[model samples]
Target: MIGKQLKPNFIFEASWEVCNKVGGIYTVLSSRAQTLLKEYGNKLIFLGPDVWQGKNNPDFIEDKKLLKNWREAAAKEGVNVRIGRWQVEGKPIAVLVDFQPFFEQRNSIYRTVWQNFGVQSDKAYGDYDEASMFSYAAARFVEIIYLSLIHKNKKVVYQAHEWMAGLGMLHLCKAAPSIATIFTTHATSIGRSITSNNKQLYKYFHGYNGDQMAEELHMDAKHSVEKQSAHFADCFTTVSTFTDKECAQLLEKSADVILPNGFDNAIVPKGSAFTAKRKAARKNLLRVASALLSEELFDSTMIVSTSGRNDFRCKGFDVFLQAMANLNSELQRQSTENCKTSVLALIEVPCWMKEPRKDLQQRLAEKEIPNTALPNPYLTHELYNEGEDAILNTMRSLSLMNDRNNPVKVILLPCYLDGEDGIINKPYYEVLLANDLCIYPSYYEPWGYTPLEACAFKIPCITTDLSGFGQWVDATLKHRGMIENGVEVLHRNDDNYFDVAQNICNTTIKVLNANKTIRNKMRKNAAALADKAQWNNFIKYYYQAYNFALSKKLK
Candidate 1:
């Protein structure tokens, strides 16, 4: 039986994506903020970089009165900060620190870091300087707050997320040893580099040295800080068991607790609102597809999508296209028999886009859906480098002509769907509710938020066992690959690209062929699985990590 856990009196969480929405870490932090707020209330403070100083950040609501005293104190200490409440469910307090001043002293700071923690910054490149300076600023902010506000007797837990905030964790470990520090690595720097470089990460995991790989991948500085933070933190944690294993092998430290990323289901619409929103989503999606293709689509049409960061190989875009081509071939063959099965597959991954295609926009503006197709109807946006664009190149290679006669149509919406992408103009979640299925066959996903979000919307999805969320699904359900379970975890590995593609095609056919009763049951099951992953249930693991970290203070 598990023992009673010690709760933290105050929790200071730091991440690069506190108010800045970038990737999956933003979803993890933002979605779970409400649950943390309910438990810790005003004591739960979030620290993020002040990247949105002059600009308007829609996700943050600035309030000068929130932490007026601390802000005044911080200003006197040469620390610039903006105190606000993150515009989410709980509206928790957020402190955005400006780290620009620290860049002037970066050289000396790096030398001191090297002297104390042996973190090598000599070969650092790219965003290393910016991230490190921001991390140092966050650490300074935390130290100042701890010294001014909180009593020494109070239990404090300082949790840092990802390699971007690793340096802050290290700083807190030394500056305020009494505060329990917890380092959570969503994905290791070296591990991602290894996979992105097309190296077979899983096969040669035991043989590859983290330091050697980091040097080879030119990620020495980031890896050094991340590994050291993992080793030195009072409690080291990861988002999933799969990542826990990766941390052990790559970062050379096993996690004390697995803090699986969870969602707040309250954001999802329910009852009549859900039905109406889903209808609107489907209507808008079909209308846009019809306008782009100049083909009238029936109400029986199916919308399937794959969305995430534009990591072509890692996110399995190659396999997604291959499977779509295969499905297209099968559908084209079946089209001769007057089959009305229409599958509109949307690639909602953001890319380096210049602007929305003017021709597509004009077509959308037309009062009636034309029967004539626009040139290059496969793409919704005009890319900066069309020839080098991976999605377009792959579509060309596969000869995936967005033909009006073909049953399977593909459209690339190469921009973020923050309700103003000029085409579908709907928030991602609103668009997600319209889909019948979502696919994310990632080869190196840490914890896939795309599939989790899909499940939350009661949409059955296909993901690979390689993803952290897919592994969780496998553990939750005795078996996978059945559509009834709401998720089909396709087996993916270094050598099984074609096999995975075939599996995806087969699963798509099965889902499309499934009756309404079966599909409804699958949708219900998907939401049920996602309900099990709500923050209310998963936040206990965080409490567990805090207990472990605070227990270290007693030692």
Candidate 2:
């Protein structure tokens, strides 16, 4: 059932988060999974890092016979096979390396490294052992996959995600040089570091001490892994058209093709008849605002919010904060007769949990820095309900301080939310329904999904001209006044925080004043634009990636 494809095509993917994820890669892979199963079921072999099951619930017993056959084949092909599996949903999917060696010794490694460097583990370093073990285990897993597919007489296309799995693909090439490899980086380490290092103010407020943290975590190896990944892959792919160009320059390796990540349209809110979607969005915002009001965080009137994984520096949370502060100043300039609006922008970011170690160590060592990062408080429960109480409690704090009578309220929600909650996770739909506008000024986004999502919801969103989606939407619509003048797109680096704030304020003013019919037209235009990115069309591109690799074509 697993290997009988109508066409002889296969995708060998290595990732830290395919089976379990920490970022957007999970959404991309999950969206494509059913389709891959439908089109390339027999040929698709997903190879992931082999995290140990240990005494965890529902033990996953690897198919020893199948594994033995794989190992025997690898031995014949002169490739080392490291085969194992972590228990996921009670079945084994052939995860490659046993990570227990690294996991078990993590505390010791942390103690040794941090203590040697005269730093504490919690304060200076973060999951150092987990990252290191992930790389080692991932590399070994790819070696096993190289033997399984290549030695077994299968033509395959190997796609590695980020630096973690990028190394794995490189390791695989040592054993199977003919395997076509695709490397995709969701974000670059250097680009992010620039923001973190340049802005000391960010670490100061966010409860993270940047200078000390940087010294312990080795930012240098992060750059090295990125460069190595770019150099080794036959072809490179990034999540967005904008990111494709950004990555080539940042990593100094040209991408063969730019594959903008696609989303599952079915999961998106659609159609006017989708009242439940509308309700879900509205309720979520109200719940969040209510919580903040209860907590006494602010007394502002205009409530502005942004959500994402809690990497504040790169996601432009600081920009949003500064913009809101600017908006506040501008609002104050208005006379009582000119219409005053008070605003509070809430920035939400979910912390990254799992990290790849090889790059981590390499980075720390190269910089001669020693540091560790902390896991998020809500890491254990990804869904909104699991962390609902905490979220409400956080909101309650904000609400108690902020006046409900104020013109605007701004808040930052740094949590992982889902659809089941009917509110917090409904980003675009909710933001469109409640507020006048949403801000997504990403410093480096690989094919941003939010802008398109907001457009689909009929929300007038402000994205940077540097974004792939912004460029695409602006180009397609030709700015024919379909969207509000305030619904304008600005280039990120072209302006400082002041200029950025002015543009945002001006756009908000424009959209808030736009005629009803015109606003409706913009919504239609957004939905039309989103239709172009349907999964059906995007799947073909993926198929082509596999086909090109199979045919041994460079492009």
Per residue, candidate 1 scores C-alpha lDDT tens digits across 1-555 of 135788889899999999998899989888998998888899999999999988989888889998899888888888989999998888999999999999998999889888889999898999999999999998888888788877888999999998899887888888889999999999999888998899998888888889889888899999999999999999999988999888999898999999999999989998999999999999988888888788877768989999988889889988999999999888878665754438999999899999988888888788897778888878888899989998999999998878755788988989999998888899999999999989898999888989989999999999999999998999899677566799889888889999999889988998899999999999999998999889999988888899999999888
Q: Alpha carbon lDDT of residue 439, candidate 2?
A: 78
- lDDT for model 1 comes to 0.89
Clashes of 1: 0
**Total residue pair clashes for candidate 2:** 74
lDDT of 2 by residue, 279-320 (tens): 555554544444334322222234445655555545666566
Query: Which candidate leads the pack in lDDT?
Result: 1
Best by TM-score: 1
Candidate lDDT scores, in order, read 0.89, 0.53
- Summed backbone clashes in each candidate are 0, 74
